[model samples]
Target: MEENKNKVVELLKQYMSTPENEPSRGISYLKEAVFILNGQGKTLAAHEILEKELRKFHDNSTVEMAILLNMMIKLSALVGDFAGAVEYSRRAQAICEAKNERELLTKVIINTSGLYFKMKDYDKALMHANKALQMAKRNGDEINAACCLNNIAIIHENGETGESGIPYLEEAVKIKEKHGMNAELPSSYVNLAELYYESERKAEAAELLEKARTIAKANENEYAIVEAMKYEARFLKGEGDLASAINLLEEVREYHQENGNKTELLGVLNDISSVYELMGDSKEALNTFKQITELSRSIFKEEQARSIAQLESSFEAREKLREINDLAEQNKRLRTVNEEISEKNNELQEMKAKLEEINRLLEKQAETDPLTGLLNHRKMKSVLDSEISRAERYETPLTMIMLDLDDFKSINDCYGHLKGDELLAAIGKLIRSSIRKNDFAFRYGGEEFLILLPSADMQRTTEVYSRLKESLREHLEIAVSFSAGAKQWKGESSDEFISIVDKLLYEAKAKGKDRLETSEAAI
Candidate 1:
């Protein structure tokens, strides 16, 4: 590796001294820079070598200079150095525009749009994406047009509704299909599926998701597979399947974690912890959050280390240059300078290690029924939305049960509100223990509580409700029996299911409480 690096450096230096138009010499050097010391892992080292070579040559209108600039643009973006990417892109764009090279300009513009997208400047991203799409379409370039269409959709996705992005995704998918761009199709399909999801078209979204998964697997595209998994996890999250979603996300999390891709790892961890919190699993959430805080701090420490390393490296380089110049004047001073620099380097290493240990303790507490430690009303509502989507996709039988303490005001009057509150808390605990892991038990404000059981029939749900009531009666010191009403899901929205069960609960109370009533599907 050291020999090859020295050889490339010598070749670049030889080429740099030659004239700009020296018959493929400049292009050859750029190609050597790309292929030999290509900046995959050691980007900074590659960038420094390439930059030194680049600075040696004067600016020119030759195709070679253009190729060098474009390569630099891509390499800069590859290393997350967007500022360098923009500057290199601007230089390339100037050459392309000056030469009236529409095709090259279109490609550069598309790349610029992508850079802006990474920068999160949606308006500028949209502007460039639109320009590139138009040029690609005008010139009959299906590949870039398809890519631009996808970019436009992504930029539009920043909108709240995501409705406006639908057309662009559809068009992009259509173009990809037309050209048989299988490598690119998965991303378009995934994007379109998400927009369809926003529009509440579950079957369409499901079909697209399946297509994306199949193609991604066949192509063995790791990035495409990971991206597909991210959307699938998100869909599952929306479907009220938190455990499954978390499992899927953990795969993605592990992939990024093992690869040392800290940015993506941070994103996946945030999603995992947020879902944990929403599922009323506070301990899991806090654990995930703790991981996030540690990773974030580690990233910060590396960045700080790089900054300090650069300053020290600069100082050392200048000191060595000075020592070489002053060799004739004094040789003894060089040893002292080296000793002082070594001590400073040691201090910097200590500081870097200290920075790594500094972490933000960002602990998240789950919102629960404080007394019973069960899910509160808000979290339950989130669960309902997620579960309803899940039920729709799997055609699963879901049952919603609403239970009210019988004549709770009268009970409060008889035993005092304190005893009533204790009974409610006890009932919450009982419900929490009785339900399945997938089931959600929520305190629905005041004396009423709700339970959602997915993939369960009406009879089984009623039995579970009866068992819970029996358990409560057996365990409590005072005699206690509550009224409950359950309604099975039959292609109804979450609000409809909730309302039907609520009405049935009211019927049980009117019929003299201490009974369970289930609403028939026909009603």
Candidate 2:
């Protein structure tokens, strides 16, 4: 015991000697001191030391101060100093309220509720417990809500009523069960089981205790398992099952021994001895009682050491939980960053689509005549060359048609340039539609238009020219007409055919306007 005490003191000195950065660091280290001193059955000393150390903090560290004060409240109550505990709790509550720290205030309310319960002030206890329950519910903290319900149940359990506490305990257990809170299941089950046992509901009590035992076993909760087993044996003993009760206690005894739970083993041995006495086995009962007496002296030291081990184990779990929470926060921030990047990518894609559409319009403008919206000389000349090559390769019959508006320059001199441009655009659209689907048309020069008609003889070429002259008179509502020249290809290259067609057009114009001139092939 002295050696253990020295080690705890050494840790305390190390903590105090270290430079404090965050207030939580100092509070966490001091929690170790409080746990050690409380386990050593020195609650009063723990309270004195914690009170003195906490007072040294400046007023700025309210959260740390409030937490340390709440710890002091629990220790003071442990040593039967209810007045001191109440004072500490009030001070802590004021700090929490001043800072509007609702989460911390919920814990403070729970502690204050317990303090009030210890002081036998049931009204204050119920008030604070209910407030804590509401706050926990609002915060979505299921564990703290269960704790609040359990506090409310404990407050009712101390009353003279028979089963007033049962409903609250059941509610706490229901929340724990619904949320899969295995850690809180065993104690809540035991509390409700005790109520049922007192009311002579033996079956229900046994069932509850059995459930608690199964859950504890599945969770690997050694402490919860022992507690459940102890209650179950008592339940069985009350129902006149002494043999089974002794058997169960012996199982518990072995579990305690194997797990180094000497403190629980002492209780189990006592229970076993009691069952033996009830069975009228006087010699065995006496022997077991002797074993318990011999074990009692060492239990104080062993119990303290075991408590320190439990605190250390609990601390490790808390540290693991803290690390998990930190990782979750980082993941949340990363997701936000990824979403922002995705939004920027979408915006860039929209801008890129707009740029591509602009480039397409610019390319179209480069290939077309701006005034007439027709393929100009450069572009349609390529089309004429391609068709001439195809006609020669396939030995297919093709024709060329050249049309010119009769007296076009005289009309342009008579009208303005805008009217001449309109006339040219009108003629351009007419020629494009007048040609066959496989034919190609071009604005060859100032007032001349060229059409390359594939698989067309002279008769087909004359028909297409007549269609254009009629369309012109209909849509333009003018007396303008075309002097047309049509020719069948007789193995002539594209340039020679175009020259022959233009000369024929001039002959038609010289003969008379509104005439068609064709080669001997047409005749």
What is the per-residue lDDT of model 1 for residues 181-217, given as tens digits with 9 covering 90 to 100? Answer: 9988988998889877744577999999999989988
Instruction: Tell me the whole-model lDDT of each prediction, alpha carbons only.
Output: 0.75, 0.76
Q: Give per-model TM-scores.
A: 0.50, 0.41
Q: Write the per-residue lDDT of candidate 2 for residues 1-523, one digit (tens) a residue.
A: 5765787788688668767666666677777777666544455567668867765563544677787887877765544455556767878888888989888889888888887776577888988999999999999988789989998887766742222466688889989999888877887898789877754456898789888988888866656777787788888886789988888888877766654444457768988998899799999999999988877756445435645654565657789768767787668878688779999999999999999999989877776777777767787667777767767876767788888888887787888777988889988888887774346677777887878777677777777888888888888844688887879888887788888888888888878868888854332
lDDT of 1 at 304: 61
What's each prediction's clash count?
2, 0
Model 1, total clashes: 2
TM-score of 1: 0.50
The best candidate in terms of lDDT = 2
Q: In candidate 1, how many Å is residue 362 off? A: 30
RMSD of 2: 39.7
**lDDT comparing candidate 1 with the true structure:** 0.75
At residue 390, candidate 1 shows an lDDT of: 67
